[model samples]
Every structure is written in structure tokens, then in C-alpha cells.
Target: MSRSEWQKSTFSGASNECVEVRVVDGTVELRESDAGDIVVRTTPPKFAKFLQGIKAGEFDHLTT
Candidate 1:
């Protein structure tokens, strides 16, 4: 519901590289704190799905 003020995700606490997110005009916006100029926008449903994928380890290869 809040818009425009980016907040670092709790998953990124105390890290130099963090994920920042905000909502704007009903869409979710996400960016890396270290690269604020670039942003990725998606619907809330899609973002939720993305988070689920992360939790399910669907993206583990990228980090591993």
C-alpha cells in the first residue's frame, strides 16, 4: 500500500548488497540498493510467485 519510499527487504539485513522494494501505481517495484538506478516492475501476484519460487529453491542454481 505504501508507495515510493524504498525499504530494504528483511532477508537482506546488514548486508552491503540488499534488495529494496516499493509499490507504485499498484505495481511492485524492486531494485538493488547498490544499483538504485535500475528497477524491475511487476504485478503483486507475480511478485508473490517469484518469492515463492525463491523459497522453493527454484532459483538455487543461480546462487550456488
Candidate 2:
């Protein structure tokens, strides 16, 4: 099946350390630009929940 174009947040701006995301065959896929061979896959609902948690600051501690 064809996959959607990979996308990364504009905030990443020239940074290869950022994560890129795309969807294929009803699954959401995420990968680190610096490590293109590795990928993480999850369902759309689960990915949405993860995004919600990130927006809610659940991962703030990990960034610091």
C-alpha cells in the first residue's frame, strides 16, 4: 500500500534529531531522522492518545 508523506514538526527546523511521522496501511509510523532504519508503529487512536499526553506535559520531564 502507498504511504503518506513523512512529516516533521516545523519546530525541528534543520535538526536531524527530530522525529518524523507518517501513516501507512491504517497504522501510524514514527522514526527518528538520524536513524532512518528504526521505526515505531502504533494505531491512529493510540497515536492520538500519545499526542494528547505529550501536549498535557506527561513527557516534559524527559525533555529536561
Deviation of model 1 at 61, angstroms: 0.9
User: How much is the lDDT of residue 8 in candidate 2?
Assistant: 100
Per-residue lDDT for 1-64 in model 2, tens only? Answer: 9799989999999999999999999999999999989999999999999999999999999977
Q: What is the RMSD of candidate 2?
A: 0.8
Q: Compute the lDDT for candidate 2.
A: 0.97
- Looking at model 1, how many pairs of residues clash? 0
Q: Weakest 10 consecutive residues, lDDT, candidate 2?
A: 55-64
What is each predicted model's overall lDDT from 0 to 1?
0.90, 0.97
User: Model 1: residues >4 Å from true position, as ranges?
Assistant: none
TM-scores of all candidate predictions against the true structure: 0.84, 0.93
Stretches off by above 4 angstroms in model 2 are none
